[model samples]
Target: MKGVMASVQDVGAPREKLQALEKIEQDIAAALSSAASALQELSKDKPAQKHVDSHSTAFIKTLQEVENGLSQQISYLSQVTTSQPHEGSSYGSQKDMHMAMHRSAHVKSRLSELEKLKMEHLMQKHTGILRSYSASNDSQQPLTPHTPQQPHTPQPHQQPQQQQQQQKQTREQQAQL
Candidate 1:
């Protein structure tokens, strides 16, 4: 009876841990979604600097949360896998080990995705800052007085009669010479 009770408790323990990991994964996914939405909003045409700064800060905070959640998931998965049944040490069933490995792989993929998103966010933020700086500079510059442009000289095609008379005179002079 004692051995059976211990076996049941051991099985229940890994299940509870896996449930906790799933909860964390869900939270991380939500954070990533929020970050993505913020990026989209920031990409809209001509947002103010104040809005950009606030969005960027929010994005950074969400990213940090996702990273922290991934770290915790990784550490927890490591513990589960390392303590798995091996030659008589009954820590968890093979199913638990497989699940932990699968979860670890998923977390790693999410981390890579998070890295790509971070790079995109940084680039967006940099471009926004540059645009605002250039816009501010343009607004501060004094406008120079407009001046009328000089009229263009008429082409030969546009003054055909004058050109023809000049050509006729030149021919007459050349014939006399």
Candidate 2:
């Protein structure tokens, strides 16, 4: 009788240990899943950062190019405007003078347009950079706990008395705790 009792106790102890191990595994899995979800949420910001960086670099390069073009255009316009038409020279025909004047005016208009465009581009780029900085700062904030709050739903067949009883029981349990 004593040997048979000992064998049963040994079997029950192993079963209880196995149950505890299973519960621990379940808890670990839940923690890992939550961590993975948080990582995925944070990863979404990387592409946006890359996009902003690329645009900033491109904008600076393009603006430099526009400035260079504007300078060249200004020099060309000055050269056209300052040249004296030779007196009694065939190259200084009335038509040639008219054409030179028209070219100078066109160049000046283009230079004005380029300046305006550069200003607009600078404003837009500055705005974008500021927005990106704000967004980056926001993204750096720590993630909040992701536990989903579920709304309580009563069963269709449950009576009002049953609901009241359930609520009472819950309150009593909480009071005990």
Clashing pairs in 1: none
Candidate 2: regions farther than 4 A off: 1-92, 139-177
Residue range 46-158, candidate 2, lDDT tens digits: 54555545545554554554454444434434434666432222434766889999999999999999999999996676555445444554334332211114323457798
In terms of lDDT, which candidate is strongest? 1
lDDT of each: 0.57, 0.51
TM-score versus the correct structure, for each prediction:
0.33, 0.26
TM-score of 2: 0.26
lDDT for position 47 in model 2: 44
Error of 2 at 25 (Å): 99
